[model samples]
Target chain A: MAYTAEKPVPPPSSDELRARIPGWGADLDPADRPSFPRESLDLRPEGAHWDFPERQEPDGPRERSVEHKFLTPVFGTAQPLTGISGVIRRYAYDRFSEGRAAHWLLLIAGDRVDAIESHLKSFATFRPDNPITETGLMAEVKRHPIRSRFGRGRADLRHTWIDPILVAGPWVLTGWLVLKVLRPKR
Target chain B: MRAMTYRGPYKVRVEEKDMPKIEHPNDAIVRVDLASICGSDLHLYHGLMTDLRIGHTFGHEFIGTVHEVGPSVQNLKVGDRVMVPFNIYCGSCFFCARGLYSNCHNVNANATAVGGIYGYSHTTGGYDGGQAEFVRVPFADVGPTIIPEWMDPEDALMLTDAFSTGYFGAQIGDIHEGDTVVVFGAGPVGLAAARSSWLMGAGRVIVIDHLDYRLEKAREFAFAETYNFNEYDDIVVHMKKITGFLGADVAIEAVGAEADGNLLQHITAAKLKMQGGSPVALNWAIDSVRKGATVSVIGAYGPIFNAVKFGDAVNKGLTLRMNQAPVKRQWPRLFEHIKNGYIKPSDMITHRIPLEHIAEGYHMFSSKLDDCIKTVVVPNAS
Candidate 1:
C-alpha cells in the first residue's frame, strides 16, 4: 500500500471519544473527561482542507495587526477644556497608550511570538477556565515594561499618547465591519 | 578525514572527507574514537529509507573526544570525552520542556514527519551522523554528555543509541512485576529490549526470531526463553498455548518495516518499497498479546503508511506506545545500572574493525557473516 495522508480508520464521534476516554486508565475520573472537551476530541479529517485559504472574505484573514495613529500633544499640558468630552477623551487616551505599549513589547521581543500566539489562540477559544491555556508566560513577557537603555526613556509630550480618537475608532469600526458587514451565512 | 560513505544499497566505501567544523553557536566538533553501525543503519543500507543521498555517512552510535566547542556549548569543553545522543534537539522547545525530546519542535525543519536524527536519511532531518573521523554536533550542551571517567568508551558508545533505545522500548511497555513479556526480533535493539525486560521485573521474557544466533544471544544476554518462529506452525497460537490462552502480558515489536514473515511481505515492503516495512511483526504482536495488554514498538520505520492491523489493536483494547527513544533521558538510570553492574552493554559487541575497512564491515554485517551480532568501527586506527 502507498502512503496516504488520510488515516485508515474513521474519526470517532464525541460519544465514541467519551466511551473510549476511560480506557486511558481504569480509574480516570469523569470530571477529568471534561478537561479534554468534545471539541478537542473531534478528529477532523487530516488534510481535509489544507489547501483552503488561511481565511475567507468574511473573516478577512486572521489579523495580528491594524493601522492606528499616535497623537502628539498640541499643548505641553492637559487641556483645560472642562466638559464630559474631556474626561471621555482622557480615558480613551489611557486605554490606547496601554495597548500601544503592549504592541511595542511584542515588537521588541520577537522571541515571544509563540507565547503571544498561544495567548491569541486561547482568546480565540474563549474558554476562560481552560487550564492548559497559558496566560502566565504571556503576562511574564508583558510584565517587565519596555525600558530603553539610552536616553530613549525620556518622556516627550509630543508623542505621549496615541491619537485616541483615530486609534480607538478603527478598532471599533473593524469590529462593526466584522459583526455586521462581513458576517458570513451560518 | 576518512568516513564511510554510502554509494548505494549494499554498497559502501571508506573515502576521504572534509573534517566537520562548528557551524552553529551550540555546535561542537567531536573527533570520533569509536562508532558502531546501528541495526537501523541497515534500513539505509538495504535502500529501504527514502532520500538517502549518495556519500551520506551512516552511524548514530558513537563516543569520541571533543575536538572543538562553540560559544553556546555550556556543558562540554575541548578535549572532554563525550557520547552524543542521536537526537538533535533544541533545549527550550515545548516538547523538550515536557521531556518528549524526540518530538522537539525546534530542531527539525520537517518537524511533522519526525524529529532530527543523525545520519539516518533525509526523512529524519538529514543531519550528518557520527560515522566519520569528525562530526559537528548541534545543541551540544543538551544532547552530548561527558562520559564518566570510569565507564568504558565501548559501553558509552552503546549508550548513545542501541542500549538506550532497547531499554526505552521495554520502559514504554509499562511492564509490572511478574508480567509475561514477548519481544519480536532478535537484532541488536531486540536483544537490548529482551535484556531490558529483565530489568523491568518481567516474570518470564520470551524472544521470537528466525535466526538461531540472535536467539542464542537473547537467551544468554537477557536470560530469557527464546523461540525460533520459523519452527512454529502458527506463532500466535504457539504463544497462546504457552501462556495458558491468555497470551503474553506485554508484546514488543522490535522489527520494523523489513520484517521477514514471508516472501510477499519481504518483496513488497522491503524490496519494492511499496508499504512501510511489512506489519507482520506488529500484527503478530497485536494477535499474540492478551486483550488490554500494552504493546511497545521501538522499530525504525519510514515516515509513511504501513499495513498494520489497527482494528485488531483497537478491538483488543491494547495500549500501543511508540516513539523514537529519547536517548538522553535514559542516561542517568543507565549510568547507575552500568555502575552497579546490572548490565554490561559492551558484551554484545562481537566484532571490531578499523574505519578504513568499514565497507567490508557493512558487507559482513548485512550478510550476517561471521555471526556478526554487532560491529564497532574504530575511526582513529591507521
Candidate 2:
C-alpha cells in the first residue's frame, strides 16, 4: 500500500510480537544460531563510487514492506496490485514483518485467490482452461500409469488415489453447473 | 524498448522500458538476441525472494549482440555476438581472483553472500536483466565472452547459466571415478548435473523427482536411472536399501526453496514462509547419502532460517559444499565438451517464446504447463 519515498511507519515492537505469538524470536539468542559467529557485519569497503545508485523512477504505486525504511532505489513495475488478492498481499506487507508466518501465509492465500481470478478471466476469452491436456492427464495414461505406481517405492503413492479428484474435481463441478444452466428449463 | 517486468507475485507483463546505456568505463550495452527463463526465476515469480521490486526485469540467462561498449572495454566490439555470464562481478575482487565469480565482493551492496546477478533483484545488485530488447552489462571485459562462431546461439545461451551451473555442481562434488551419485531434481541444472556426472566417471547416476515427464527427460537426456519420489514410502530409506545400506557416495540437491515432499515443511516454508525455503530436497540429500559422503548443493535459497538437517549432516560426518556457480571458470572445459558432441545444452529447451509473450512464458513455466522443461525468449523476433 505504501508507495511513498518517505520512511514507513515502524513495525510492532518485539515485546508486543512475543506477547501475541507463540515461539516468537526463538533464534534471537546468538547461542542458538550456528551462523552467529560468521554473521559479523564487518562492512568491508565495496568499491562503488556513488553514495546511492540512481533510482529507477516508479511508474506506478509499488509495494513496500513496513519493516523497510523506504523502497529500494529501483523497483519492479511489471505487475501491479489488483483485485482482492492485491489487498491481502498489501495487508501482509503492511502488518507483518518478513519474519512473521502470517505475512507469507496471507501471501500464499493471495496467490490462490489470484489463480481463481485467472480462471474466471479465462472464461471471458474464446479459449477457457482445458484441464485435460493442460493437466497432463493424457500423458499419465500413456506413460506407464499402473506400472509406475504399483511396485515403485514412490513416496507419493499414499496420496496418488486422491490426486485425480484434487485435479479434476473443480472442472467436473463447473462442467455440471454449465450443463444444468443449458438444460433448456427441463 | 520493451522488456519483461515484474508486477507482483505470479504476475508479469511486457512493457515499454528505457534503452540501456553504458554507465561505467567497463560497461557494455547488449541488444538481447535470446534470453531464457531459469527455474530459479520461479522463486521470484512465487514472491519468495526479499526486496523484489515491481517493474524490474526478470532474466539472468541470455546471449546477445554487443551494441555499445564503455571506453575501457577492450575484448569486445560493437556487433559482436556475445554470451554473458549471469554473475556480474569485477574480475579483480578477492573472490573473483580465486575464480569465485559468484561471490565477488564489489558488485552487490545489499549482501556479502552472493555477487551481482542480472534481473535477480536488488539483493544481487540491481542490474536490469536481458529479457528485453537491450540490457546494460557491467564489467563487460570480464563477464561477456564472444560466442564461438561455430557454436549455435541456442547452445551458447545454455552455457550462460544452466549447463555451467550443472557442470559446477558435479565438479564440486569431488567425485571419485566410479562413484554412485544421486541427484535430487530433474530441472535443466539437475539434468546437466546427471549428464556431467558421467564425464566425471560416475559409475551409476540416479535422478529423482515427482514429475514423470521430467523423470523421463532425466533418463533420455542424462542417460541416468530415474525414479519418482512420490511412489516411495520413504525415499531416503529407498536410497539406503538400493545402495546396499551404505547410501549414495555423493548427493546433489538441485531443488531449492519450494521443494515439495514433506507436507509440514512445505506449509512452513513455501506457504507460511516461516523458514526461508523448504529444506525437503536438502534433508533428503543429507539423509540419503552415506556417512562421510560428499553432498553438493547448487540450489538457491534465501538468506534466512531454513530447517536444514544440520545435526544429521554433522552426525553423519558428511562434507557439504555449495555456492553460486562461477560460470566463466567452467567454460573452457564446457566449450570442449560441446564442441566434441559429448553434450548438447540446447536439447533441454522445450519452448521458444517471443519477448512480447514472455508473461505467458513465465506463467507456463511456473505452472509446469505444457511439459515445459526450459523456455528461451527471442527478443525482437520477426
lDDT of 2 by residue, A1-186 (tens): 333543122234556544533333332343332222221233122333343434445556666655556654433333456788778877876787666767656665675565567667757977565454333244344334566455544444443345456445655898999999999984
Off by over 4 Å in 2: A1-186
Write candidate 1's Cα lDDT for B200-223 as tens digits.
Answer: 666678999876777889888877
Give each prediction's DockQ, rounded to 2 decimals.
0.01, 0.03
lDDT of 1 at B83: 92
Interface RMSD of each: 28.3, 16.4
TM-score (all chains, Cα) for each model: 0.68, 0.72
lDDT of 2 by residue, B128-181 (tens): 798999999887777899998999999999999999899788877767655788
Docking class of 2: incorrect
Candidate 1, residue B130: Cα displacement in angstroms equals 1.1
Superposed Cα deviation of residue A110, candidate 2 (Å) = 16
In candidate 1, list every pair of residues with a backbone clash: A71-A162, A71-A163, B257-B277
lDDT, candidate 1, at B321: 88
Interface root mean square deviation for model 1, in Å? 28.3
